[model samples]
Target: MKKMNKAEIQLLHNSIQAEAIEAMQKISEADSVWRCAYEKAPDELPPQEETEKLALLHHDFMTALTLLAVLEKTMPRNSTRESLLILSYEMFKLTCPNTFERFGCEDILKSVATLLDSIPTPEMLTAGSIDKSVHMIAKAAQYLPKIPIVPKEETPTAATVTVAKDKGKEVNINVGLHAAFAPIVPRLTVFDLSVMQAAASIYASGSKTFSTNQLYRVLTGADAHTRITSKATLEAVRKSLDTLQATIITIDAEQQAALGKYRRYDWNETTFKGYLLPMTKIETAYYSGNQLTAKCDCWRIIDTPPLLAYSKTIKQVATIPQKVKRLPRGVSATVNNICIRDTLLYYIQLNRDKGAKLNYSTLFEAAGVDTSDRISRHRMRKAVKALLQHWQEIGFIADQTDVIESSKNDTIYIS
Candidate 1:
């Protein structure tokens, strides 16, 4: 498509702003409709008979927002587009204050303002202007809600559970990659990390794609013994996927190879930054009149050297004794808990046959814990204690009577 000129861009911006204002006005009018239909104010809960109408209105509003976002994508990256985004932000602030806060519009506004400031005037525009324009566009796009259009009367499929045998199954994660980049990028919640691991595992199994339900099952570890049939869990997984998609990770030349080589080696450093799961696509499908199905293509991980290296390391470590390589069953129920397990396993593997007593701080850092925060320090201490207990249980350590010493300086010693 041809890039939009200044005039065309401004016209489009004005059109979208006017449409948004009209929509807000219509929504306000809908409040009166609700009052008449249900004999209740907009702030009050509707009667059962009007609930469907209210739901339909909500769905329509969401669809409108999505369309507005789609429209924003068509415009050229310039002051005009930025102005439209700002106008949209203001409209949301007025019409849907709760939605604005929930979607983090404040941060989006700040980011857009920063990008706009960085852009030079047309007369002073250099080759770098094109790059800055692209950056500004992407930064603005991040704030747009990528919410799937939920169909009414959709029923989710039964969650699928795939349990690998504990004897041979091993999780290989790049301790170095996560330690280096996670603190710098937006910090993923424990559940988000779990979803990422699940996706990684699916990719490692030679599958390029997996469904959101598959992710939820892997995350919940639902089995015959433990059934995790929670709608909330599925919703949480979806939300985490949204957050992961919006998160942008930047890698300079220095950190590129250290983290991993990109699949697209010819990235325009002026415009491009490292994104987790770059080039991957997410598709939502509705099949055979079933619930909306979301799937992620993780082919990008294959090209990522860090992930590949981590997977290779995992396979190699799997050959070691279970006492050293595997965490005890039930220890890794969550992402943070699993981090502790993997950290200890890596530490033990690093010190194998050397009998070196690695420092607690080093292990904690290697485990991907952020030690800069006091709460994180406390968490690390607890993780260390848990690891010690698990080691004793697995006979990796001598016994409960074995004396693991700690110095006054807070360094732990493992004999």
Candidate 2:
């Protein structure tokens, strides 16, 4: 009587299982009533006591199952829940010291039955009643000197789970107790712990054959919104799981090849796509503006010869000869230089708008030089080179592409 022997524990374990199974069946029937009502006249269905009773039944069944699992570890194989009832009754009659010492109960069957009857039926399952029941459970361990041992050391091994390829990757397919009970592992509830044990058994098999969608379905729980909050965290997790970069190698071969051709050059995609192929440089272009300015690298014109010529004409028209003679020598020299540069800039501007390749003759013609002037092509080429070199220094035209080669007769084409 000092301790309930293995036989007595087995009998108690079986009794609890039988009672739990019966309660579960009754709970199922109660659920069916609401389901039928929902299907037939859902709009007219009212909240009722039967529904409440069903909930309580389910709650009690879960509690009983957890206890039975604990007892099973200590009990014999052949003992049934009915046998447990008989044995407890007999033990109580004999005043068994073991039963009283361990459970601190002289009547185990009577105590268990009393506890089961205390469970609230659906009608009586108010918030307060539920709270009371939960409190009773928290204190129930006091009824026994030693709490039932629930195995925590046992874990599912890799061999038990069956993994299969899902989009060419392995996944867990374990169906053991530990895996099943994973949801409740973090809780203080005994039912949760029991589920954890069950899951451990199933988890042994490992991952199963599941596509990305199916895997999501299996792992996703009801409360996803409460778990994932920030966009950054979600994005980071997604990137870690994604196989897109590896897959892209096979999918975008043509793009890769095209990119490889220009990989050595210092051009990015935008330049290649828009202007790389049509890039060019021009050599001998006449400027016909007042100030002889050169165009820069970005295809901008600075000065031309025509403008210079116009300014000179304006000066001659506005100033008298006496006033001009009164001016200093330095001032006159400066005026002359300005006139020349402006004339050259004007001529360049005139040709810039046209598609023609301008040379000295073109400049002379645009400037309206007389036929008797008889300008040599050689002298005109020198003038053009000076203008291009000036522009080159300012980076209007890159020096590397705008070289004035005397060997090519000083004629220029955009490089």
Q: Pick the candidate with the highest TM-score.
A: 1
lDDT scores in order? 0.41, 0.31
- Regions of candidate 1 where Cα sits further than 4 Å from its true position: 1-198, 212-225, 228-275, 278-306, 309-335, 359-383, 391-415
Model 2 whole-model lDDT (C-alpha atoms): 0.31
Per-residue lDDT tens digits for candidate 1, residues 391-411, read 777676544323254554464
lDDT (10s digit) by residue, model 2, range 276-342: 0011111222212233332211110111112112222222111111111111222221212222223
**TM-score, candidate number 1:** 0.34
Q: Which sections of candidate 2 miss by over 4 Å?
A: 74-415
Q: How large an RMSD does model 2 have?
A: 41.7
lDDT of 1: 0.41
Cα-based TM-score, every candidate: 0.34, 0.20
